[model samples]
Target: MAARIEIEGDRCIGAAQCVLSADKLFDQDEDGFVVVLNGEPDGEDLEDARTAAMICPSQSITVVED
Candidate 1:
């Protein structure tokens, strides 16, 4: 199965680390909160997702895999 990225909007502080780490997989909304560009990411994008989750200060991003 593919990896799925999940963001807890309430936990996001609009740091945008996700965007900086993985622009292809994540983006910021008008309010500066996290907006998922691709919920399911693969290949290099999946690696970026993991990086984003690790770098997120607020720990709002989660990558679930099976």
Candidate 2:
């Protein structure tokens, strides 16, 4: 399935769970805010995005199906 990855920077607490859970799809800026490395992840990468969304303490990560 295809999905879109979204990150809410204002809601992020810089916990880095997204980065830890899905490094290929997500990263952190210099200030440690969540960054989307690949907003449109597919295959196993889609799973990574889902994991990141699940583990985000601040609920900053979102995976919307397209």
* Predicted candidate 2 versus true structure: per-residue lDDT over 2-57, tens digit per residue: 79998778999999988888889888899989889899999999998898899899
TM-score of each: 0.96, 0.95
Candidate 1 accuracy as lDDT: 0.94
Taking every candidate in turn, the Cα RMSD to the unseen true structure, in Å, is 0.7, 0.7
The global C-alpha lDDT for each of the candidates, from Candidate 1 onward, is: 0.94, 0.90
Off by over 4 Å in 2: none
What would the C-alpha RMSD of candidate 1 be, to one decimal place? 0.7
Lowest summed lDDT window (length 10), candidate 1:
1-10
Write down the TM-score for model 1: 0.96
Candidate 1 per-residue lDDT, tens place, 1-66, comes to 578998889999999999999999988989999999899999999999999999999999999998
Q: Best candidate, lDDT-wise?
A: 1
Report the number of backbone clashes for model 2.
0
Error of 2 at 15 (Å): 0.4
